[model samples]
Target: MPDSIAPDALRRLVLPDRVHRSLYTDPAIFDLEMTRIFGRCWLFLAHESQIRAPGDFVRARLGREDVIVVRARDGRIRALVNRCTHRGAQVCQAERGNTAGFACPYHAWTFGLDGALNSVPHRQSLPPDFDLKDPRLALAAVPRVESYRGFVFGSLAPGGESLVEHLGPIAAVIDNVVDRAPDGEIEQAGGVARQEYRGNWKLHHENANDTLHPGFVHESSVSAARGDPRDYAAPAYDGHQTHTQMLSNGFGVREWQSLSLTGFPAGHSYMGGFYRGGVLSPDRDDPVWREYRARLVARHGEEKTARVLGEDRFNNLLYPNVSINAQYQQIRVVTPLAVDRTRVTAFCFRLKGAPEALFHRAVRFLTNLSSPASMILSDDIEIFERVQGGLANSEPEWLDQSRGLGADRTEAGGRTVSAGLSELPHRAQYAAWLRYMTAAA
Candidate 1:
C-alpha cells in the first residue's frame, strides 16, 4: 500500500538522533508507521465512561480501518469493524450512539452487539459452504481489546506484546491519569472538540509532550487567561493577539528543564514531569483542587497524593496513538487519515464532581488557546505544514533532534535525562521510532 516503507527509505533514517525527512514526508514511510507502529501498539480505544451503558459506541479510525467500539450487553467492550460482512458496505454509520444491534442498511444484514451476524435478509438462498455460523461472517473484531484503569485500548496484531507489557514503565503514568481523581474515579466532562489541521500527525503528537513551545506559541491565550476576558469581550483574531499564548508556550522550555526520561523495551518511553504543577491550576486555593487534594489524601494518604500532584507532567506521548496529558483536562487522540491529512480530537474533562469553574477554565484553555480556532494552535499548525512542505526538497535529508547528546542516563528498563531542557524526550521518541521501524530487520 501507499504507507509501505521501502528498504531504501529505511536506510535514509539515520539511527539514534536523527530521522530522515522522508520518514515525515513520504507516503510510504507514513504507511510503515501505521503498520509497524500503530498496528502493533495498544491504541487508545475510548474511556470506559463514554460507553458506560451497554450498546453505547464511538467510531474511530485505527490506521486504515474504521472500527466501532461498543459496550456489549455482557458489559464487555468490543471493537468491531464498521464494514458490513455482505457487499463490503460500512455498518453502523453514525459517529456514535446506543444500538442494541447494528443493522447494515445494504441488503438488511444485521449484527449483534458482540459482532455476531445474527440475520441475513435472504439467507435461504446462500450455498452450503457459506455458513452463517462462521466467525468470518461476524464483524471482524480488532485482535485484542484491553483497558487500563478507565482507559480502553485495542490492537490489530495478535503477536505483539501484551498491553501492559507494551506500556512498560509508562503504564504508571497512564494509571495516574485516572487515579488522581477523587475516589479514583474520573469523569469525562465539558465536551469533545475535533478539528482538522493541515499537518502530519507526528507534529501534533510530538508537541503534546513539548514542554518547550507553549511560552512562545501560546502567548495570546495566556494573555486571555491572565487578562480579564470581560475587557476584550470577544476580540477579533490578529497575529499579535497570540502574545500571551506564545509566552505561555515559552514557559515549557523554561519550566520543563527537570524532565527525567526513561526509555522502555517497546517504542514507548516515559518523559517524566516537565511541568511543576499547581501553576495553571493551583491546588493551594482553588476549591476544586482543594477538594481533589483532600479526597486523595484521605484515600491514598498525603505522601501518595503529594507524589501524584507534585510531579504533574504536561503529558506522556504513548508511542503511536494516545497523548495522555497528566495534568489539566486535555486528552488528544490522533487519527491519521492519509499520508498528509490528520484529524486531532481534543477532549476536556471535569474532575468528577469538582467545581464547574474548573471545567470552564479547561474549556477556555483548550478552545480559546489549543483548539484549531486558537491563535497558538494555528502557529504550530503553520510550522508542521511548512516542515512537511520543506521535506520534499530532496536534498540534505535529516531532521536534527540531537540537542543534548551523551546525557541520556541509562536506567534499568530505559535511558533517562533529568534536565528537562535536554532533548532527551525527543531522543527517547526517535529511539522508540527507529526500533519499531526496524523491528522486523
Candidate 2:
C-alpha cells in the first residue's frame, strides 16, 4: 500500500459489506488517512465556553497538526497551527491558559491571538526585505472554522463542505445536548481524561455502536455487577454510578435487540440508550433529578423539557474522530498518533443552570467510562491491542462487516436504521471513508 494510493486501488480496499484489514494495519494507509480523511473532514475542535474571554486558548489537534484554539481580542474564535513560522517550532507549550501572545522558545517569534505575526527578538538580524507584516511570517491558520450551538469544528482543507453540511442530521444531537441545559449553554468542566491504546483509531468508532460486543467483551464486569448483592435501586443505597452502568450492560440479547441503531449520511451514527435503572437512567426520579427537571421546565416549559430529556441516545459518533454522548454530557475525541497507536481524550460538560449534582454526575460518568483507570475502558483497550496484534498476520486479509447486511432500511430523513446489533454503522462509516479517500483532487 503506497502513500499515494490510487482511487481505484482505494475502492478495492472497501467493499459494500467489508473492508481490507490493511486499512487498519498499513502505515502507508494511515498516512494517507491523516490527509484525505482527517485533514478534509470537519473535526470537532473546542467548545465556545472553553475560550470565553479574549486571550483564552486551548490546545487541540486536527489529525497530526497541533493547533491552538483561541479567542482573539475581537472576541472571535480562531484556530491556528501551533507551529511558529520561524523554524517550525511549537509557539505555545502550555496545555491551556490565557496568554497575551505566544512566544516561540526556539526563537522569540511571537504571534497574536488571531495568529498574526506580532514581533521577533532579532528583527535587525533578518534580511532587509523581511516585512514585519508578511502573512507568511505568521502562524498558519486553519482555513475554515465554524460553530453550531457553541460546538466549534475546523477543516484543514482550503475549501469543502460547510460545517452544517458536514454534520448532516447529526446536528440535532448537538442541539439536544445544548437544549438540555436550562440556560441553553454548556461549558467544558471537570477537566479531561486521556488514554492511549495500541490500536487503530477506527476501532473506537467501530466499537462505539456495536451493541453485541458489550455482552461479550464486558462479560466479566457485567457478571461481577450481577453477582453483587447490593441493591442499586435502594433509596438509601450509596455507591458510584459505575456499578449501575456495569449492570446495565448485563442486558440479555432480547433487550439489546429492542434498542435501535441509526446511521446517517457522512458516517454519523447513534444508538438508542440502554441504561434502565439507577442514576444513569434518563428518567431517574430522585430529588436531585426533580430539582434539575424543575429548573429545565422553568426555562423551556414542561413540553419542551420533556422532549429534551426524552431524547434517548448513546454514543453518537461524528465520523473519523469524535464520539458524543450528548445525553450524558460526555464527548471522546480520537487522535491517531500512528498506524498502530491512538489516543482518546474524554471531556464532560456542565449544563448551565442545572443542579450542581447533575454536573457532578456527568463528571463521574466521564471518569467511569473514559478515564485511563476506568474498568470499562481498560477492558476495551486490551481488546483493541489484541485486535491490532491479531491483524499482524498475513492470512485473512479482509475483515467482514456483513452482520445484518441487507436488513438496514432508510428512513424518511435519509438516515439508515438497523437492528441494534447490526454492523450497518461500520458499513456506513466505510462508505463515507471510501468517498473521502477516493474523491477526485
- Candidate 2 on 1-441: residue-level lDDT in tens? 334788899999999788999999998899889888887899999989989999999999998899999999999999999998989899888889999989999878888998889888878888999987899888899999999899999999889789998998888889999999998899999879999999999998999888888888889988887764654446423344667877777777877787788887699998875553232574566798899999999999999998888888888899978888877899999999999999999999999999898887888877778998787888889989999999999889999999988999988867899878789899889988888888765
Best-performing candidate as measured by lDDT: 2
State each candidate's clash count: 29, 0
- Output the worst ten-in-a-row residue range by lDDT, candidate 1: 238-247
C-alpha local distance difference test of each model = 0.71, 0.86
Q: lDDT at 26 for candidate 2?
A: 90
| TM-score per model over all chains | 0.88, 0.96
- The residue pairs found clashing in candidate 2 are none
Candidate 1 on 1-441: residue-level lDDT in tens?
544565455756756667777766777777888887777778887888888899999988777779999999999998999999889999888888898899998888989999999988776798867877799899999989998888889988877678888887677766776666665777676667787766678777666555566666656556656755457756634322233333445454545665555555454545555444324434445465577677778877889888877755556667777766666656778888767778878786666645565566567667755576767667777777877788769988777776667776777765464466556666667767777776772
When superposed on Cα atoms, how far off is each prediction in RMSD?
A: 3.9, 2.1
Q: Pick the candidate with the highest TM-score.
A: 2
Which whole-number lDDT from 0 to 100 does residue 380 have in model 2? Answer: 89
